[model samples]
Target: MIMKATGIVRRIDDLGRVVIPKEIRRTMRIREGDPLEIYTDREGEVILKKYSPIGELSEFANEYAESLQQATGHVVCISDKDNIIAVVGASKKEYMGKKIGKELEKIIEEKKTIMVDQNADGKIFNILEEQEGDSSYLSQVIAPIVSQGDTIGSVVLLSKESQVKMGDVEKKLAETAANFLGKQMEQ
Candidate 1:
């Protein structure tokens, strides 16, 4: 059976019991007795996640990327284990789930730079000034969605050289993303 990002068939009965697909359970490290957390986004996006920091952050980053694309006209790229796992608000899939081991991946590896680690709480925002191809500095905001001393993933906000700002609304949204991640990591 092929795994899809969406379109997992589920039916909720009157008693409210939902069956999770075996594939999802296995990939998320969810055992028979393992705990799961459910969350609803502002757009009423319902999601079920494992109680691991990695799992929660992954979910938060994906959604946050979508939100950033909506608010700003920049492409949001999310990576995990040096692989670009998801791409949001971009015209083309520049680096979706692409394993970063050769060029860019090497740079990230050498930096040993972690935007936010696990146990990151509240609205923590950091702006990184990255040198662009034109020898200009472009700022990007990276916020990690953390829970239970683990970092599931991160939210990346991209903007032009002069338009990058981690404002109040962006900070709150990042916090909410983290909260959602935390809730998912709960039992």
Candidate 2:
């Protein structure tokens, strides 16, 4: 006995956009151009079904972007070598405007990764040391966005000037942004 998987196939328009029937979409858990798997039976009957597979990581970068914004005491910037790609949080504009923020350049020229100052707490985020400012009391963190054996870009965060020491919470947030950005570039 062949159980029919019933669904309506609306025709494609001039722009090549097709509207699948609502019931079919709901039944198959389809959401707009979600690729369908099709086949034919012995009697040349068409079979349509949904193909479910996890997609690339960049597909959900927005979720991470939102989280980055929610994160406290930090200005996050996702950037490529040439320019800033995306900035999440209030201080994004200020961080992105600086051209010397490319951390990878220093990594290449110095042939070493600059270590974060252990006593450094909540102030500003910088990809490279441009000027010697007394923002040492400012909480800041930066992570190089590297994926698939290549250094794509970097992310940065400035800690809030609260009594809270720059602990695991701030470190985790910075790391998450960096990891998410690296995943985005990989895709």
Candidate 3:
């Protein structure tokens, strides 16, 4: 674990509350009501991690991604709001655990489904911001997972082959997977 000291400190009040700096909150994407997991190590260090409900289903997501990859013959990625949690297919190593790009974040925020292919304006988007100019997929379908009226994650189908045109079938499959995952969260 690489830790960087921000050179900022705060003292706890009588109520046992120490305000987290605004800069850190923004950088970590921690909103007002977001849940945070606090951990203390034997080394006397305290760690705060943003909690993601979808992250609790990591194993289930991996199985879902594998099944989707087999059924669609393409790469399948299941991501929480901030990072790709599960990925299956040849590009799994490249995308797994990576922070998703801004475009995908917008899609999830909008709670919409989108398909991109050679014939559909050719607007290829990076799955990860770090992969800005290195996107290898020729087609993609993205669907947002909305649980209990809250958009939590997404399911994506990606193909590297130029001949694999993503159409209604792929769109529906992604949407179905996203819906299934969302329903799982409800339980």
Model 2 deviation from native, Cα RMSD in Å: 15.5
Q: How high is the lDDT of residue 176 in model 1?
A: 60
How far is 84's C-alpha from truth in model 3 (Å)? 0.8
Off by over 4 Å in 3: none
Tens-digit per-residue lDDT, 1-187, candidate 1: 2335757888998999988888877555456755567887797777775443343356565776687677766556655433455567653344564443333333333432223222233222222223123212244445554556544444455544454554556555545654564556565
Cα-based lDDT for every prediction: 0.50, 0.51, 0.88
Q: Measured by TM-score, how close is model 2 to the native structure?
A: 0.48
Q: What is the per-residue lDDT of model 2 for residues 87-133, given as tens digits with 9 covering 90 to 100?
A: 56644555443444434445423322232433554234345335345
Which residue pairs does candidate 1 place in steric collision? 53-152, 54-152, 57-153, 84-97
Q: For each candidate, give its TM-score against the true structure.
A: 0.43, 0.48, 0.91
> Model 1 segments beyond 4 Å from truth?
1-64, 99-137, 161-164
Q: Sort the predicted structures by lDDT, highest score first.
A: 3, 2, 1
> Which model is ahead, 1 or 3, in terms of TM-score?
3
- For model 1 the local lDDT of residue 48 reads 71
Lowest summed lDDT window (length 10), candidate 1: 126-135
Better of 1 and 3 by lDDT: 3
Instruction: Let me know the TM-score candidate 3 reaches against the reference structure.
Output: 0.91
Q: Model 1 residue 87 lDDT?
A: 68
